[model samples]
Target: MTTTPAAPVATDDVRLSAREAAERHLRALVGRDDARLREDQWAAIEALAVDHRRALVVQRTGWGKSAVYFVATKLLREAGAGPTVIVSPLLALMRNQIAAAERAGIRAVTINSTNIDQWQPIHDQIHAGEVDVLLVSPERLNNPGFRDEVLPRLAATCGLLVVDEAHCISDWGHDFRPDYRRLRTLLAELPSGIPVLATTATANARVTDDVAEQLGVHADGTSDAAVLVQRGTLDRESLRLGVVQMKTPEQRLAWLADHLAEQPGSGIVYCLTVAATQEVAGYLRDRGLEVAAYSGQTEADERHALEQALVDGRVKALIATSALGMGFDASLGFVINLGAPASPVAYYQQVGRAGRGTDEATVVLLPQIEDRDIWAYFASLGFPREEQVRETLAALAESDRALSTATLETRVELGRNRLESMLKVLDVDGAVQRVQGGWVATGRPWSYDAERYARVAEAREREQQAMLGYLRTTECRMRYLREQLDDPEATDCGRCDNCGGLTISASVSEAAVAEAGQRLSRPGVVLEPRRMWPTALSNLGLDLKGKISAGAEPGRTVARLTDLGHGQALRALFREDTPDGPVPPGLAQAVMDVMKDWSPEWTSRPDVIVVVESATRPTLVRDLADGLSRVMQVPVVGTWAIRDASVPPRAGQSNSAQRVAAVRRRGGLDADVPAGATVLLVDDQVATGWTLTVAATAIRAAGASAVLPLALAAQG
Candidate 1:
């Protein structure tokens, strides 16, 4: 019903040609995709593509960082670029990204640990310009063959390099990986001037600087030019951050269960150690709750299963270490920390894991007082002394040539594992050159001086102390993050342990038993050992002065006796008057009781009766009297390794040992026992009864009158 309309005449007055008109029309045909049309997101996309070719997006966790890359990748595909290459550290992320891209009808594939062995096909596709995107890992890029094979081909196509969790390039980040260093080398192999877009939830000034320098964008190291898109405040009105200091591990777990019972929302329970992770998960599982555990040692298949279970809600709570949080996207309503996180960066990362897909989430940290001391020990992380360094360096210098770390360490008396860390430190300092099996000393002294080492150790100690200080940080945790990001207008985000319901009590001076403290340095009258025995007497039963004559002249005096089974400390221990001089008063009774109890009705032979104080916790014998008093009724004694327990955990052992001998009669357990005697041994728990069984054996061996185990809890 229509007639062809005459073609409109072009104003070709020495101007608009038909081709120019067609170009104009094609240019206008490029319409904005609705997928990225959100006002803020579109602004970000346009700013990225047209305004800033290289950008750093500091978005919160699960703010759709992948979406940003998706829009970019699609635009590039539309422009007929050869292909896009994405360098992703997490294999799960690569898979998810590939799926998302495919769902969006964009051709994309992954090349990483899972498929590096069969990378030939993927490489071929890249060479053929068949791939729309290739996801990679830093480790894969580290391979010379892989880089040479794929980078050049894709570099010619000139798409883009998207880096996920790029903060790892900085040492300040929690999960820094050395393989990330090789990324620049891969970039060099790729087409010149390709864009690099890196994203992370937590990168501070130091991290941003490191990323820029490592990527070569910070040539001349312009720290200010580092691209960062600051995301505004997120909605977390429902989150409640709470922290609790517990006295024991079991108590912490029990408290956690009770808290979970109150809410019972989707959550993740993070454990500091792998053993704890499994045990906690097991406890939950035993309580008829679903649980999946993740640790560094977990198998790849198991990790994948657990992660999927987390996403699917098949598992109510996933007990994991920090390793499980990478690239995991779960709008988990709650995240719980079983102990103090090793670093503030870790704390932020773990807490950020919650409230991903939802507006409301909660984070809880159960800080046990016992763990405070443990973490404080790590906070004072020790590096070997310069003497240790010198010893190690001397060993390295003397090494025949080209030795591995393991081999080099064996040559030193400082110990192999402990000695090697210093060597690596020297290597890092550029004082030594490592080639193959051994290190060739640079002959350039690492300024080998004690002061320099001291400074370096101090710097490390300060950094750790800073992390420890976070435990007592009064501000909300999110505000802490803002401070780390170097923002000027920061506020206490009001969803942290301090801002929530945690109320701190003012320190009150104690009036009762203030003088009962175990401080040995308080000004006091000269405190001397009891005159009942010599001050120099050992903890074990022994006569430091003269051999205790078993049949000494009878008198009510602190007399020593030989073969009474009393330890050297018995020489100093108080003695009760006996018919035969003064015998270690209660010691003889304990030995006799152990002998009789071990071998029902057996009279005990004289055995060492040392009064060791109650050693409820494992500690040094000298620093604090631990495990000093024991019932001599047991045949065998418990010995402590002479190694100094007082030394910091990181420092090597002091090489000390303490022995506990059995309190038993020379006669077997079947021997007759004297009437009207009493003995008791205390334990926290009697699990499996093996400890009691062995105690009976020791009592019989020590010639104890009897052995009776009185534990708080005994299993039938």
Candidate 2:
């Protein structure tokens, strides 16, 4: 896909003066009668309205990036151009932009996943010229129906095309989306005189160049036009940054509980994972703080409510994951990170949400030792393997009919989300197409581009390393982050802790730490049983599909290995380099406590204790089972032994299908427990729970009435 620019139309050659119109639009947008357009904002509007040339604006967050587009849209519409089409990335962003447009008296509408019911009506409005701006998600550009039908119409008549959060168009950007790559097609198809504008607040120099190139700006005269690049300093003078190194997650939680109320106003607390967000928010709420957990698992309506609550200062903060990172709008008074993000670029973007309109905002980072482990977990889910891609292509080529994602799952081993992500990347590469009901092979030549993917992966590792350096750096902390983004004019801000010596206190009260320890140490997380079998198990020679014939009983784990409190200890105990031994005395004691405190929902008391025999860590499994048996005063039953010692281990199983196949073939029931007896089943660590499920199924079939699984730690 090529994104060459159209020829530049000089300002003098333009027929209209957009400066006065832009100022009028800005006043309405900010609700100030005397509001004036900033010079950069007016320049961008003039380029789009008068000069009809593509422009990329890279500025700091809260620097009126939205104004450039809104004013440009108003001026273009008044000139009788087609409605402006904006390719926005996030739902929150769309909501904020639409509201901003309404303030400026521009008729704006959005087409996203939430409002499919109104898509046709919105389409009608666009065609009837009743809308001034139409905002669409980047993912919509690849929808077969939308691309084939609506996109052509949009391209033919669009007044101007705006790519919001344009950094996502470049792989070098901290947050890259495969869907944004399809903007090349949209850009190439646009009419000759229709202008384009790409806006972002977090891009560094490298990302700027990549985005500019994608828009057809090249060093040699290869493009149809030249791209006008406008970049500004990224320094956020209102943000006072600091890092507090906490030896333990408990200390971090204790600090927050003791000090969150001291913060100036409502803000955000970012956690690296969904589980962490829930745990942190729960702990804060227990301390009588007004806060809520927000993550990808949060329902749409609940997310909206939480966003509103934070905006209205009803809650102290929203403990959130990166799901709440971008497009969230609030002049938040502070931003705190439970642990560092994988990269400084991402870190800046998350914290940038704070102090947008305030005189000062506190930005603190509480670095944890387990951050690397969390980073590794997410890194494992990157681009699919070339073999997997080939398999997907071959599978699609085998049939003439289109296949939905669910149906395709039968033939591919990838999880549903991963499969969809791969398909999208392939679609942009022209190897596949999303049809009405599903997907079809385009039969176009496609290469895996191994070198490029490998390079990107290597870049991610470098970013992770840079984040560690940022935590330890003594030079200005804000400058460290800015330098990572390739900000050329980066300088010491003299505001961060490194520049201004420990602004946030490192000490936490003993009472708070004790309370935090008690809360975190109260173990046992409910382990829900796997309800449905992985789809298309039959394709893998297993006669399993839909719901399982007999699902395993809900089980309990002492704690998630990723839990902030027990996580560090549990992780060290389970490290690959750690020598295997019988269960540690302390962990064993914790296990007993977990059993003693098991909730009433775990109604079935075990009469017999059975263990899933382990080949890799036999001593650990046996010792744990023996300890549990002694505590429960139950007879130790036989084991669910491995059928073949040579069977591959399930240690690194990444997806469900491979995990199911591995566990089913390697282990089986050997216990002879009495009928109608509840069995206490024990295992070392449960990652996907397939081993536990397989063992439980066998035990039940072998005469046990029920199985209650117990594990040392659960790996989420």
Candidate 3:
């Protein structure tokens, strides 16, 4: 949507000083006659509008970072400059910014993943000077067509460049993004005299300096005049920071159910995982709270609707992951984290969402022991090893044509998400180029930068340690966080728990605890069978292609390994130090519950049970099959053995193609199958589902009419 055009610059307005004009614009933007620009905000706006200087603003959230750019855009456009180009990070932020721009009578339009059809028209408007501000995602910066075509003209003509969440440009930032690093190329292409503004509330001193350096580089690869770095105190006086130590996931849920209604207004309840969001939101809703789950997995339309719901007070809270971290604007009364973030800087950013437009808001952290495990899981998705990177580059170099990510997956052992992330970094480093079809090697020399990656990893570990320290800290929470961000003006915030300005009850009602316990302990997760084989399996010496002719029927698992309830138990049972043994009685009962819940959907019970040999937990797999066989009154059949014991375990394989190839290479089903008999296949756990799929294909090939796959836990 476009904003209202600016009112004509009157003869009298033309004579007004820049500061006076900025104050007038601020009054219009805030829709208050008395509204005035804060000194820092005005300074930032003037730097860009009057001085044509690059600036980085690292003030706290809700500090009017958007106002600096929008006001500057108005001043620039009114003086015959082209529209400002804002490389925003999220659609929610774009929506908020567009509305804010409209308030200032600055026309704004956006091009993001949500509006592919409108991109051309939006670009047309941009070129025609009909749009006063253009907001695009950082990913769009490297689009084949946009980067090769539209960006040059935009860079040459754009009056101002704005990078929201500028911390993402540095690897040291808590929310580092490889796509943001592409801004270096964009900055290099811009003509001289164009002003740039990078804004983020989450950056620490290191990130601030790195972003400033990146912002100051000239088109000639030389450092230009120092960038104007405007950082302010990060303390939020309106926030009442506190921490409630939770011994169990159930207690955390109960605490939320017990006190959510007491919170002043609708806010956010942040979880570390998408599964947790659904779990927590469901439990809260069942307890009569109006809440919904939000994450990257949520559809675009639903995310928008849920955001509006929270804004309109339709929902008490939106249980979410980091997907809701940036650009979500609500005068939230509380923000509760069910688990702690790995970094205090990231934690500060999420908590910043609260108390933005309110006089006072509650910010609480309910730290769990499992948070470290969750942190480790996320850290594992970072840049792949040097060997994996080299393999990816070699694959691209040898290919005659550009290889799609799916195709490349068969050639290298990196998951799709990690592979795509690496490709973006490579593209930014000039070692690869993304064209119309996919990605191709540019034949540019590239180094792995092992030392740099090690430093990043070390920094991450230190941040994680600091987060743990936050959990144990007895000092003022706000002051501790501000100090972590290197805020020179940090002082004890008397509004936190330690300072006695706020007191939160740690007790949860017995009834709520019992109900929460029941919800978390509930078992059973649907395991949808794989229908299609991975593409280009031949690259890995596999003969598979297209849809599988012999696939297992839909099955059931006791629970996802990531589930807050059974997940915790499963994690304990499957720890690396945990000894292999027969299935525990409790877990066996849960498996039975899963079966009972799933029985209604099955056409018939299986005739026989078979076990997929587990190299890691052979005894556990066999015992699970034997127990199921006795319970279901189905005879225990022969085992499906791994043909070659020396073959490497499937755990080491990263991508789907590699896992499939590894499973197929070890021959399947060793025993004869009764023709037309249904077979029950049991495994300890299912991560990629490839092993089960390959084994089921073998069972079906042995003339079984149907194969039913069962696993104790499914990886989320």
Give Cα distance to truth, residue 401, candidate 2, Å. Answer: 2.7
Residue-by-residue lDDT tens digits, candidate 1, 199-235 = 7877666666667655543323223233445454442
For residues 1-716, write the lDDT of model 2, one tens digit per residue: 34454455556525345676677788999999988877777777887888788889998889888888888888888888999999988888888888888988999999998999999999999888899999999989988889999999999999999999899888878898889988977887776778899988888787898898778633343464467888888899899999888887789999999989999899999999888999998888989999999999999989988898999999999999989977788889999999889998999999999998998999999998889999998888888899989988998888788888866766666777788889988988889888888888989999999998899899899999999999989899888988887778899998888888337888899988998998887778888888888765676788877776665788898889889866666898889998889887777778878887774666678899888887778999999988777777888888888897676776326567767877887878888889988888888888888888888878888887888988988997
RMSD to true structure for each model, in Å? 16.3, 2.4, 4.2
lDDT of 2: 0.85
Q: Where does the lowest 10-residue lDDT sum fall in candidate 2?
A: 216-225
User: Candidates' TM-scores?
Assistant: 0.59, 0.95, 0.97
Q: What TM-score does prediction 2 earn?
A: 0.95
Q: Give the TM-score of candidate 3.
A: 0.97
lDDT of 3 by residue, 211-234 (tens): 998888866766655478999999
Order of models, best lDDT first: 3, 2, 1
In angstroms, the error of model 1 at 35 is 5.2
Q: Which candidate, 1 or 3, has the higher TM-score?
A: 3
Q: In model 1, how many backbone clashes occur?
A: 79
